[model samples]
Target: MRIALIYPPPWKIAAREETVSYGHDGPPPGHRPQDLDADFYQTPYGLFTLGAEALRAGHRVKVLNLSAYAWSRVEEVIAGLDADVFGMSCWTANRRGVALTARCIREHHPKAHIVVGGPHATPLATEMLEHHPEIDTVSLGESDATFLELLGRLELGKPTSGIAGTVYREGDAIRKGPERRAIHDLDTLASPHTYFDTHIVMTSRGCPWACTFCGAETTWGRGFRGHSVRYVLDALERVLARLPVKMLQIKDDTFTTNKKRVLELCHGIRERGLQFFWSCDTRVDLLTEPLLREMRLAGCQRLSLGVESGSQAILDAIDKKITPDEILESTEMAKRVGIKVRYYMMLGNRGETRHTFQETLDFLDRARPHEYIFSCLSIYPGTRDFHDAEAAGFVDREVFFTETFQELKTPFDASEEDTHRMNEWFFANSGLRIVHRDGVADYRAILERLGDYHAAHMDLGAALYHAGDLEGAEHHVRRALELGYPLPGLVHNHLACIAHARGDLDGMMNHFSHAAKVDPQHFVLIQNVNAARAWFKQGGPGRKLPLQLTVRHDFQLLERTVQPTLPGPLPEDWKAWNAIALPAEPSATYLRTPDVEGSQHVLKTRTRLKVVV
Candidate 1:
């Protein structure tokens, strides 16, 4: 069977000037600036897992990342696709897009089966089926085994109903089957890194705590389950080999939930000689000084903490289970070990007052994390906030089907006065705020903990260069290059700046040329190269003036080569396999089945189809 898994855009984005052909023989898509949201444009990692599962079973699969495509391009791609089943990832931010895309698929291929699943669809499966007839089935929660089984049933012309972890439409009634058990052993499933070259990797699933605004517990169940250290290291090695820039985001719910497991994983990474910079999200309370040091030595460049609120009252109300003191201590400890600390702050939760708001701001000033980003509370389905709001009649399920908002982003139970104040402050300081810069002393402390590591040496060298220690900076920067630092362009760019500091124009030009030749994909190197070209074009060599240089390494890489991360081309007789009967055995070890037959409550409402032009 031919399966197409799509990552839909949040909404219909307007066209932009940039265009690129996305592994299709047609006119390229107009890449819009709105599609550049790092959070939204990133193809969800689950689709890759599903594609791998299908391909392993000798099926043809196409994983298309239409997350950044304009509406016209999405239509063209959807129309061109020839598949028996269509799988789409739905999130609170892109719920409408999922519906729109499902409708488009039904219009083009009336017989194709449509399946939707994600954090949003897992909880609101029945409502989704009732509102949008375009969606045929909704796969609920950790759907690796469930998805493969459903595909087998579809191929054999079997009913989608009576399958574990699925709710399907049969005529006019929506029937849900038995609840699918959580996969006891994650390693039993195929690893996504084996097939796709994505920078995102999840080493674990589920969080122990149920933060009010989060739906992690809803999707990943009540406890944390991590992949074995060996499994993770293997995934890392495979992904690292394919990436041009050896940087990854370990996107787990709570990465450091198992401190011992993390320590062992870190040791394994070092033992295997896997060199890459990574960042992970975790709670501040789960961290310790020793663990932070070990993680930094193992190439943990940044640690993002879910410090929802700095006010103890607000934290307690949200069941955050951590005090403001813990947040401060964790931030200081991570900074002490040279790991850049980024706090994920929130604007509004259960209880919000003027005093509490002020407390958050004051706490931020005291904590002084390297970076912080704040977002308003969004009441997602299956979350504590969502259920509580529904029971209190504060929000109706119909709002999700009616409201055009990207997310239900509103202050939960905040007073009107407090809401106004928070919104004003949020709009003013919403994006990532870089509050702290590492000085020479800070870098020295970092280097002491992570000795001779390429990244640490480069960071300390940059700090030394800024502090006017040209000789010391040159020695460390050269040392970093000798240690086989991945991005030599950054090292040579630093050398160019150092030479420019002195009166060595020839050395500066030579270093810049070497940087451009080695790795011109980094934005910083590109900026310096463009500046040099313009300067020489204007006869800078003959002028008696100093050329200004910008020396910075933000670890951002421009993707020069775009390899299509999809399954190989199918054989001519591949479709004939679908007609062959095959047993659908459970892939992973099952824990237990829950009662999810659910009340047959169907909402008699029409879904409003609106696309933002």
Candidate 2:
């Protein structure tokens, strides 16, 4: 059978890609930038693994990366393919997008079998079949074998009764098959790389850590599992031989979960002289200077660390073992050794407060890793955090459905006003400026108290730019400069935008020159050159100012506080802003209308929003 694997695009946030879903409230307060790109939406690994299994079984296969392409484009890519099966992976965050995509596929190809898989569908298979009629079957956990069996049945026009790990709709009722056992001998499965032209490999499955907010423990269990070192090494050798793979992403929940095993893997890679750059996700506490140095020697170029919080209390609340001190030491060590670090921090956990929130800011001062990711704590179903929130009275039990979980209202440890204030505070002082603060005086006060007004200004400027408020963007940019915010290469580019908008040719040229001088290797400079050429061609001003500016701030403070330091690099384009054409009127409106007495209750009572933006 011919098959098309689909991945849905993330939600749009100020033109950036963000994960938005019906089951959880949007990202935690002040966590992610409005413009985070869609880099994370790569090909779905599960589908690739399943597809490889199918192809090995002699079926024709094609992949449609809907995450990279829109629904219309995905159709175009698969237009001529005579595929009998369509498989889709949907996470809670991308379920809406998946559902919409499924409907479109049904309309375009009514006779094709539609199958759904992934974490969101695993536990809620029945609900998915009942609610979404377009989806013919839902594959439970570990879909490779299950998908193959289902396809085999489809090929022979046989009943799906005996298939394991599948929930199929029989007339109006859903019939679930036997629970599929996870493949223990992972080596027997075909390498996921076979399905794609590129190289990718997984060293392990499951994570040892049980962070309250994470779904890993709930989805894959707390027991860490891995293929033998020899299996992993052989897979690497095969990939290196067949594909021009410049980098290897160790697609593990936590690569350092087994320190001894990771050390052995690194040594093996070194001994083989793989000469490939690699990246992996790890916790800060697990990393040591020696391990980082060893990994660096093995061509490890990037490490994404989940430094969930700077507040010790919040860390404890979420069962995150590392302290603020550990975060500081590990990040500093990583920086010292020359490995690029991406810090993933979580905001808006239960028990969060103004004072504890400040602890995070203080922690940021010392742990200062390269790129800071501020994400809201999402209470995914079956996680400890979800239960904790529900037990603590934060979750509205009535709307918590077994299938298609929903968050009725934004749960807060403080009032909505206080929650919003804390969010603004986090954005202003967390070494990353990516929040909107029009009338958030308390948050601004906290920034001022922390000596971060300059950083706050840069953040506000970026927020305005993203919001398409050009005048406001200019005002904040000037304020950032006046407050003596460090103007990195990206900052200079932002200034050039302002100068261009104001028609100050000399100022634009000067700022652009400064930007080039500071970060000659900046990617924005390429765009600058292109814009200059375009302006000259149009016989217009040699440079036009940008309608908005992007801001970058120092995050080096995190390094000083954490321990057993690891070395790492920061993200490129430290700061950036471009000239955007503003809409004739505000494209989106947010209301701060007065709350009616029973309105809050009613709003809190509703399980799911009729329309999710």
Candidate 3:
């Protein structure tokens, strides 16, 4: 049996513009935004675990990272793979891209069996099947065992009705199986690192906290499930055998959830002399000097603390369960222990306002985590915040996910204009200078003074581009470039957009090429370069010239040399693509048509494939 795991690309905004500052004040003097590459090393734990399971079952397994690869090249990569089954993992942000990828695979290989899993699928199983006919099954909940079982049944040419937690198509109807049991014994599961040859490991499953905006509780439940200390150390040993294992990214929602267990694990790592650096996520309140010192001694290089809000009101509203004092103390303690700390802040929570937003700024100034991540909250289905928003009259019940504006879905009950203003203020104030006055009401004045010159011009250029005023956009962009602004990557990207709009194919290519050159390691710029190349090769009407920007020596080599590889088997024709196996027992009603408009346009077509057995 052959299995292919596909991780779709992230949203353009998140992948390109969202930098993983971890807690840095801002991008270096002249910082540029770039695309986030989906390295095999960075592949999600679930996908790697499932891949390892498939391999353990004697199936040929491959990982197709379409996220790291440009969208245009997806078909080429799919055409190059050789596999029997295709599996895809997607989050809410990248659902559209996943759907598009599934459709493309079905169009190219109609006989290949397709499956969709991950956080997105768990809550939207019915919607996924109804919306995308090309997907043969949606593996709801934990899929490591269920997926392997489904593969076994398929290989034997047997009916898959016995396999629980799967939704598949049968004739004109879709059939869903009974809910599968979750993995209780963590030791039985193989290390995901075995499949990827990477150092990433999951020490625990499930989050202890119920953050209002998070969907983790709904997907994995609130109770924390962890592997034994022995199991974790064994996994680490296995990983160190294969790779240099510089950084062990513990993909636990809260590594410090079980204080005793974490301490035990830390002690084990120290005793074993693992001599490897690691990072983990934890709550601000969980940090203690003892734990921090023990972790640092055991090579815990970094910690990501979710200081979701600085305002006590917002924190309580979201059940963040930490106070400002706790946040400050935790930061100071981590810094004292010589441990790098990254603060993950949520900007748009319930009860967010100009005042509360300012409180966050003041908190950052006080706490001073190594990096600050300010993100607008998203109202995902199944979260308490989502229901609360509807209950509080923020979101209309009639509005579907697609119809809801991205900014409006935030837990923060504020106008879009206000949100934008706060976003601008957060970025501007996160720099070296204190550009904002504590009691000043002059928003525009503060923006003009504290904001990066190039960043402001870039914003204006972006507005013009969105307004379809390409020429005006180009003029502002050129001004940004000529100002000798430090953010060359952003400047180059805007120039690319201008070139794209003005029918300057060479100029578009040159700008993207320049952006990529300036920040060769930046995934966003790399993606832009790939997109530009693909568009140009397709004879599109845009700039097609290469960039002339300079970059760091190693980064330049990485850009020129690194190429993403395909994950699964390729099919010759579209007719052999596999359809999702519908459930034998109907538990819910299936709508003939999806609730949203244009959904049918995006729906995937199904094809029949012959079983290998």
Task: Write down the lDDT of every candidate, Cα atoms only.
Answer: 0.78, 0.59, 0.62
Ranking by TM-score: 1, 3, 2
Candidate 1, residues 333-366, lDDT tens digits: the string is 9988888888888876888777898999999999
Pick by lDDT: 2 or 3, better one: 3
Instruction: Residues 457-504, candidate 3: write the lDDT tens digits.
Output: 544565666667778777766775675543466567767766766667
**How many angstroms is residue 261 displaced in model 1 relative to the true structure, after the best TM-score fit?**
0.9
The prediction achieving the highest TM-score against the true structure is 1
Worst 10 residues of 1 by lDDT: 597-606
Give the clash total for candidate 1.
0
lDDT of 2 by residue, 319-409 (tens): 8888878877887676555566777766667667667767776776666565665655555656676676667654633333322322223
Model 1 pairs in collision: none
Candidate RMSDs in order: 9.1, 13.8, 16.3
lDDT of 1: 0.78
